[model samples]
Structure formats: structure tokens, C-alpha cells
Target: MRSFYNSETGAVSIYLIIILVPIFFLQAVLIDFARVKAAEREADTAARAAVRSVLSAFDTELQKYGLFGLTGEPESSESLFSMIYKENLSGSSSGGFYKLLDTKPEEGHASLTSLYTLANHTVFKEQILEHMKYTAPIEFVLEITDKLQKPGAVKTLANGSAYAKDAEKIEKLLVKREELLDRAWMETVKLKEELNGRHHTYRARITELNRLSELIGLNTADGVRSQIKTLEEQIRSLSDSISSLNGSLAAAAAAGPEAAAAIQGMMDNMRSLQDQLTELQRRLSDLKTLLDNIVKYTGLLAATKLEIVSDDEKVQNLQKSVQELLGEAKKANDELNTELKRVSSAAGNELKVFEAFKSLKILSEDDFRTYQTGIASSAAMFSGFRSGIGSINLFTNANAQKIHAANDAYQAQMDEIYQKQLVIETERNKRNETIRKEKEKQRSKIQAALDRARQAMGDCGTDQTAGSVSAFYETLEGKDGLYGKYMTLNESPSNAGGSPVYDLEGKPDTEIQHAMSLLERLGQTGESIRNELFVNEYALSLFNYRTYGREVDGSGQPKPLHAMSEPSGHKLPGQEVEYLLYGFNSCAKNRSSAYGEMFAFRFAVRMVEELMDPKNELLQAGSPLLVLLVSAAEAAVKALADMDSLTDGKAVPISSKLTNPLFTFTYKDYLRIFLLLHSSDTNLLARLQSLIELNTERTLDHAVTYIQGSAESSVSLWFLPGVMKLMNGTGISSCEVRENRCRFISRADLAY
Candidate 1:
């Protein structure tokens, strides 16, 4: 190489230079090529970053308005997009790699679309749009759907509205039940007071009769007769009093069937207990009179002993009175024996108090059964809803807890109001207070959202259907638009009177209205309010027909007649009504088809069946009330032992007979004993009142449970479905850019 450059080899060096010239020239051209390529790559990167920035703006606006742009609230899509593009373009257009005109209008242009035609929203459109220097046009399309159904905005909204309405219905039923319980509690109080008064009277009579009792022995005839006559008069008065009490009791039973049945049970116990005491008193009075008269005659005989041999007319009269009194004593003793036998008979005469107890047992048991059945369906609905809505993640578990608590609080208030002995107005008042508060909370949330929308979009009135980007896209694409079929599917149902309009694009205010509907339904809950849990309303109607013994018309509504137990053609599994009456056929009815009637009629029939049982065990032993009555009887027996003149085993037989009747004192005797033992135990009445208060509370709890369950299910059924449809279709997307990096939202997140 040194020789080639040396002047000694000048001729050879000149030839080498000629050869190197072409190589050096080629190397310089390659170097310039590398620089140009590097410039192009940098320009491409800047353009990608700028376009991505603009896309982020679009995403923000689209998210605010709902990806489908169906939120009837205005959005700042166009203005924000324009501003973001200007900022991004100006910032990235620097670095001197490419040229971009700073002039307005024709100098800068952008086309946004779902990709149907060039003429639509097109400044330019091609596989690679012309005159779009250094980059390719970026395009993205949103396709929302629900694979579960006709997944789209319209279907989602429609289902949501239906679910919301159904939830309202369930909530209303809870409120209705509370009102019914209140009424029942009031009636219970009235019945308790009346029966308690009768009980007190019977107790007093028992005490007086015991004081009059003594063993069969002897006494003066005139004094004995006078005492006997007074006793008989008192006994007759008691009988008349008892008869009047029974009449009043019957009137009390004429109240609503549910209350009447419960009240009637107490009345029967009171009556039977009173009768046992009355009979016992009558027998004891007879024995006392016979014993006193016998003692008097024996005394006269003793006094006449010294004068007996001489025939005095007075002595003859005294002798005759003694014999007559003796005969009466024997007869009285025989009658007492006979009455004791009947009182001891457990199967034939039947223990009186037990008969009343049986009715109560059956009624209470049946009521519980009804309650369980009612709640079971709603509970299932809630479970399903909870699962479904969990996926939607908009309505939270906390929201469910709050919603259920509101209903429970409303019921609790009803209990307090009823305890105040308030009437129907109290029911209305409680509803108003709770519902208003809940509604206010809903309204406040809606207001906050609306205020935010106003701040963002100015005074664009939340009906953005006209100037909205969504509308523009639809108009641009028309029948062949990417979302044309979705739009058609989401169209609203025809208007129903007094219902809110359904335009697919829900207004911001619509959320508030839905909340109001929920409160109204909850407030409207009553005895008449019915629901079909885990099934459609129409299906519930069919279930009712099968369970309630209804005949169905062609239209599938139940047609009930006055006579119940008519066989319905259909049968649902495990329904007692179906087994008894043939089948329940309708969801609701005018008179005999109601739930109260269903139970009332069945219990009434069962009451008769139990009363006819020979065992006298209908009182189905083992209750706090029964134990109290029996204990009272034992006290009476003890008091008899403490009584004057009756302690020398003279009253032992009577006490033994009463305490050990049928190997144990019968319910009748027990009831008599209870009245006598705790005559002043006012706390008994107070305890019973507590039970009465529970009537409404128990009902309200069950109702609230059902409502909450249905509400949760409805959110899944109505609200979450809309979003899920979007997730299945629109949330998933793909794009390939020939000369650009596509900037787009890859995930759909919502906070509704």
C-alpha cells in the first residue's frame, strides 16, 4: 500500500486512485441514504405519538357519554378532540424531520369514523389515504354486544327498565306486609284486654267459692238454707256473666280472619277455664250447704237428747228436720260424685283449655309455613341477582345492604307507630318518612351527576341525540352503518300511559325517576301486594291458580268463585293449597283467593277436625300459657289444704280429685287454677302484648328479605346486562395500521 502512494510508483498510484474513486463515491451515497431513512423513522414515531394523544382524548369523551353515546347528557367530544389534536400535532411535528402546514382550515384536517364510506366524515379515506404525508390514517370501530341475548344498547336499556320495575314491585310488597301486621297487632291488643277482664272475674269467683266450701257434716236448717240460696244466686249470676262474655268474644272473632282466629283461641281457653271453675264452685257450694245443715241437725239432736222420752211437738219437728237434712246430704254427695266423674273424663268431655290451645297451635304453625313459602322464592331471586350483578360491579354489596336496611327501618317504624295504637294514618306516615328520605338520597346522587355534566358540557340540555357524534355516525352510515342493526334492536317500546318515555338514550334525570319508582313500590307494599319469586309475574299468576284453587280463563287470569276447595286443573309441587283445594291457578283474587283466606279457610276446617277428636288432646300440651294455668290449679289445691275447718283430711278428697284428674289435672282444671293462682299477675298481659307486637315485626322482616333478594336479582336482570352485552362485543377490539400506530381504549370500565 505504501509503494502504491509513493512518487516512485507514480504510474501505479494513479491507477489505484482511479479504482478508489468509485468505492469512496459509493460509500458517501450509502451514508446519505442512512440519514434519510433515520429521518423517516423518527418522523413516523412522532406521528404515532401525536395520533395516540388525539385518540386518548376521544376515549375520555366516549367514556363520559357511554361508549355508545346513548347517555342523553351532552359531551365535549368534538371540541376536546380538536384541541387535543392541535396540541399533539404541534408538539410532535417539531424535530424538523417532516413538514406540516401551520395554516388553518385546509392546512389541517382529521377524519373520524366507524368505517363505512369515504364520503362519510371523510377529509380523506383509502387503504392509505392520499396526501397524508409520513403516516397512514388511524381507524377504530366500537362494536358492543351481549352474547347472552340481543346484546346491544337498546336491549340492555329495555331489560334494565323491566328489572327496575320488578324490583320496585318486590319492595312495595314489603311495605304492604308491614301495614297488615300493624292491623293484626291492634286487633290482638283488643282481644287480649277483653279476655283478660273475663279471666280476672273468673279468678275472683273462684276465691269466693273456695271461701264458701266445707265438708259434708251439720248446721242449723234456716241459716244453712239462707247460705245455700245466696250461693245459688251467685252461681246463676256468674253463668249469665259468662254467657255475655262469650257473646263479646264472638264479636271480637268477627274482625279480620287472621286476628279473629288468634283471639278466638284465647277466648276458648278463657271460657273453658271459667266453666270448670263455675262447676267446681257449684259442687263445693252444695257440699258446704249439705255439710253445714247436717252439722246443725246433729247439734239439735244432741241438744234434744235430754228431752227425747217425752213427746213434745217441737222435738218432733226437730227430729223430722234432721231426717230430711240427712236425706238431702246423701243426695248431694251422690251428685258431687257424678260431676267429678265427668270432670275427670279427658277423652269424652275433653279438657276445655286444651281445645283452645289446639286451635292456636295449628294457626301459628300454618302461618309460619306460609311465611317460609313466601320468602323462599324471593330469597332465591336475590341469590341469583347477587351473582349476576357481581359481574356488572356497578351496584355494590354495600348498596344492597343500604337498600335492605332502609326497608327494615321502615318496618321498625311501623311497629312503633302501631304500638302507639295509631290507625291507618300511621302506616301512611311511616311510608312517607322513609320513602322520602330514600328518594332524596337517590335524587341527590342524580343531581350531583347532572351538575357535573353541566360543568363539562355547558347548557347543552341532556338530550344530545341531535348533535351527538353517535348520531352523526349513524346518519353517515345510514342503513349500511356498522351499528345500524344494533340501533334498530335497541328501539323503545310504544308508550304506556303515565310511564316514562324510552328513547334508548337514557336522560340523566331518568336515573332519579328509577329511584323514585323503587321507593314508591316499597311504600305501596301491603297485604294485597303479591309477587312471584324466581319467576315472571305471569308465571306467578299460574302458580297462584294452582295453589289458590282458581279456574283460569283463556287469557290465563284466575277466575275464582265463592266456594273454595274447587279443583284447579294445574298442580304445582309441594303446595298445600294444591293438595287441599286441587291446585292454585292465579296470582291474586278478589275474595276467597287471597293468602289470608287460603290459610284461614284451611285452619278453620282443621280446627273443626281437631275439636271432633275424642282424645281432648287438641290443646296439644306444652306451652308457657298452659303451664301457668296448671300451676294455678295446683295453688288452688294448696290453698284448700290451708283453709279453716277443711284441713283435717276433709278437703283432701276434693283436692286429690282436682289435681289428679286423668292422672294429671286437665287443661280446664289447669286454666281454673291459673286464674286463681296469679290473679294479680298483670305482667302476664304485658308478656302477651309483646307477642302481639311481634306480629308486624315478623312479617316485615320476611318481606324485606324478599324485597332485597328481588332487588339484587333485578339489578342483574336489568342493569348489568346492558354493560355485559357491551363487554362481550364492544369491549373486545382489534385494529391493524399499515403506516400508523392505532391509539384506542382497550378496556371498558364503568361507574354507573
Candidate 2:
């Protein structure tokens, strides 16, 4: 058999049988493996298709707002997944080498592994950015952002009021300082005149005394007696002048302490003059006594032929005493003149202070320091003058009576002096009363101006009218829409007389605070708010809000918003954006809060625009406080008008100075700007969910943004029964040629 086994033909046939059997087995195994791999790939494709279908069943309503979420329940998504999975598997290449039989998805395997909702900021932001990528002009958005973020383009609403308050305080203080200096200067002028008059009268009295003393020294006994009569006349005249001067001093004392001190100094000089005159009179009398005694004794001695003693030496001594008194009086006159000149210089300096204080149009730190220095210098001058003159000795009424007693001729001049005193008293009382009233009036005026300034600041409310602001608001009557209504509702009655001048004291609106917080957080992270702004713009485009008169379409055509679920089902107001911002169920509360915030931001923008405008001369001239107040009022009114035009869906200038008329923005644009300033992501998202629920009549929890789906397909094994058996208990059934099968799982994860 082995050799016959060596024969050629039969051996070749046997060799063919041996080779063909193993090759056939290997080919069948490879075909089954290829079929299994192909089926797994098909399963993967089915799972992906199924998950994609689920995503495709997104909430169409949300798409209108540029958002995406899986509609319906997760359980309902299974049926949709099953249908798509089966369809894709069944459609897989049936004409291929290996047939995929009973290629059915494993039941319960078509489940979502993960599901993400719009509550996630990442998903929500992605969707918004996606929407804006197609709809919004990227360059336009960037341009608006760049413009709003320009230096000083946005400022705090309180800045204007703060500037105004500071300016007002400075102005009031300056005016008060000016009034004080002017009063002191007026007192100085009057006192200087009185001092000069007293000085001239003293000089004249001293000269008259000198002449009398000289006449006494040179004349005979009869001539000396006559000269004594003239000296007595001069003494009587000086005494009357001293009495009048005493009354004048008392009158001047009532004007002010400085005036009183100055007049007292003059009265002291007059008293000294009276003393010198009295001394001269006494000397003359003594001389006269000596002469009379000599005359009587000489008459006796002449009868007895004795030599008469000459009294010329004593007369000459008396004349010398008079000359010395004249010299002392002249010295006193010179000292008084110097004092008066110094006082005049001080008064002139005070006048300069008043002029300097009035000259300041803008209050800089340097100007403030200069004013303080000037005021301090003037006050020191007046104080010094008062203290310097106070050192003079007091002239008592008893001393004045001594002068009067020295000459009975003083009594004859008493009536004229009394008349002059009465006139002076009447005039002084009138002038003092007038000055007091004037001071009070000026103070009242300053207080009134301050009051008006404070009132203007608080009048930042929308209802306020300033200068041309009345006309401005009137022009916005119809276009401002709900802005005016809400402004009136939110208007604070008054400043309460002394409320904080700036917006610093009161608490900001809760909505505004929340919005600002969002902005701050975004700023801290250095994150661009472009996406947030886009989302807000999307919301404005899709949602409902109070408009000028009617809601406008994307094409700027007006339309009725009767699609708001038939009125009875409407849970939100017409001002839905306002409600979202404020989260108040009450329409007025929501609308007013939104309006208040909008006004605040708009007012800030307008204020910056107004302040930064080079053409605005208000800050350069007139009362700076008034200019600031008027500018604030103008900004308030302009913001109102801006709100008007925006609500009307008309383009309003971004900046009055640098705005491109063609590049202006509308209501939705402004709303987007405000949204960029919004603070809390969680709060905003929660509100968005609530809004979606209300609008779509769907539960927020059912909304899905991301979902992970796993699917399996069953494929029968025909040729690889042995390998199938090896894979058994490892999620593969024991292989029988026609009936056994294996299952393959595929995962599909998707996000918004």
C-alpha cells in the first residue's frame, strides 16, 4: 500500500483532498471573522445614527432662541433610538460576502449613558456662540465692544453728582469767605477815616497850644493874660473834642472788636492831647498867678522903689514845655498814621482775597490751597490789627471830666457835641442794622444755592426738567414706551434735604447689583463677554418686551405679539426681559427695576459722553456746580430719549460727540450691552430655564444638552462555531452553525 502509495495519479488526487480541506476550513473562519468585524462596525454606525437622531429631535422652540436641548423624556428617546438603530443595521451592506442575519439591537442596551442640560453654562455658552457665529456680524459686535470699552466711555452714575457736590461746597465756602473779608474791609475803611479825623484834630489842637504858649512867653502881663484867655479857649475846645471822641469810641466799639480797638486807640491819643492841653493851661495859670503876684508885689515895691523880678524865665520854661508837648503830639500823629496805613494795606489784601476767590471757575487742589492761604492771611491781618490797637490805655469817663473841669468853655460846645453824637448814633445804628440784614441775606442766598444744587442732584429721576430737558423729554413722549412709566414708578420723591449727594449712600437696585456682580466676575477672569452679549441679543430678538407701540419683526416691521399663549396661559408679562432681569412676578416691579437699571447705565454712558465732549464749555465757565448739575440733568434727559429711540427699535447714537450716525444701536443692542454687565451665571441660567418652561410648557429638568447613548446589535455566527464557543460566557452564546450569535456594543456621546 505504501508503494502503490508511490504511484503518481492517485497520489496527486489524495494530496488535493488533503490541502483543500484545511484551506476551506481556514477560508470559512476568516469569512466569519470578517463578517463579525463588519457587523461590529455596522453596530457602531447604528449607535451613532441613533444618537444623532435623538439629538435631531431637539426642542424646535428653543432653536428660535438659538438654544438646543433634547425634547421629550429620556425614556421616549429610547424608542426613537431603537427605530434609528434598527433601520441603520438593517440597511448595512446585505450584498456583501457575509450576511448579517437577525441583526437586531439588544433590548434595553439602547440607553443614554450621559445627558447634559442647558443648565450647564458651558453648553449654554456654546449654543449661543454657535448661533451668533452665523447670525451676528462679528466685526460689528467687536466694534460695539471696542467703542463701549473706550477710555471713559463708561463711568459711574455717582461721578457727576460727586463732582457737582464738591464744586457746590467749594463755591459756598468761597462765597462765605468773601463775605467775611468784605465785612472786615468795610470796617477797616470806616475806622481809618475816623482815625485820620481824630489825628488831624489833635495836630490842630497841639499847634494852637504851641502858639498860645509862645504868645505868653513873649508878651507883657496884660498880653500874657490875654494869651491865657486864648489858651483857656483852646483847652475848652480840646475838652469838648475829647468828650465827642469818647462818644465816637463807644459807637465804634459796637461795630466790631477791631473797629472798637482802633477807635479806642484814637480816643487814647485825644485824651493824651487833652492832658497836654490841660498841662499847658495849668502852666499858663501858674505863670499868670506869678505875674499877678509880681504885679501886686511890684506895685508895692515900685511904691518902695525895689527892683522888680522878671518872670520871663518861667514863661520861657512854660513855652518850652508847650513845644515838647507839641513834639510828643506830632509823634503820636505819625504813629497813628502808620497804623492807619497798615490797616489800609490789610484791607487791600482782603479785597484781593475776595477777587481771587471770585476768580476761580474750576476748583483744583492748587486753587483750593491758594484760597485757603489767602483767607488765612486776611484773617491773620485783621486779627493782628485788632490785637495791636487793643494795647492802648483806656480813656475813662472821669478822665474826660477832668478835661471838662479844666475849662468851663467846654460846656458851651456840649450841645453841638451832643447833636453830633445823636447823628452819629442814628447813622451807626442804621448802618449796623443794614449790614446785619445784608449778611443774613447773603448767607441765605448761599444756602439757597446749595439747596438748589442738592435738589438738582437728587432730581436725576426721569421726571426732572432742567434747562432744555423739558423739551427733550417732550420729544420722547411717544417713543420712550414703557421707560417713562417705569421711571415714574421708581422715582425717589426728593433728596430728603440731606440725602447723600452722590449715589454712594443708598443701596443700588438688586437687579443692577446682580448684573454688576456678573460683570465684575467676568472682568476678574479676563473673559470676553462676547458670548454673553450674543446670548442676550438672541433673547431680545426672540423674546417679548415692552416696545414703543407694537413689537417689531426682524425686518423692522411692526407686528402684534398675539402668539403669547392666548393671554390666559401667559405667566409672564409683556415685559418678559424685565421679568427675567428682576425675577419679580409683579409686572410693575419688574418693569420699574429694569427701567431703573437701564436708566442708570444709560445715564452713566451719557454722562461720560457729555463730560468727555470737548465742545462742552459748561465745565469751563459759569458756576461749575451748576454746570455739573445741568450736565447731569441733560444726561438724564438724553438717556430717556435714548431709551425711547431704542425701545422704538430705532438706531440711537452711542456717543453724541464721536458717534457714527450710521453705526448707532437699537433696543436689543442696548439690552445686549446690559447683559454683558450681568453678574450671576446660576441666577441667569435658572431664570432662563424658568422662561423656557413657561414658554414651551415643558419641565426644565427634561431639557437635555448632552447625552451618551450605548447600543448593541446581535449578529449570528455561521462558520466560527469553535471560536464562538471559546468566546462563550464572555457575553457570547455557545455557537451552533445557524442559530448562535454574538452581540456587539457601540457607544455614541453627543453634546449641544
Best by TM-score: 2
TM-score of each: 0.17, 0.48
Poorest 10 consecutive residues of model 1 by lDDT? Answer: 705-714
* lDDT by residue (tens digit), candidate 1, 45-79: 43344334333432222221111111111123333
lDDT of each: 0.30, 0.50
Local accuracy of candidate 2 as per-residue lDDT tens digits, 648-719 = 556666666544445566655555555555544444444555565555655434568888878767777678
Off by over 4 Å in 2: 1-22, 90-102, 106-109, 137-528, 548-570, 601-626, 633-652, 660-665, 727-739
lDDT of 2 at 671: 53
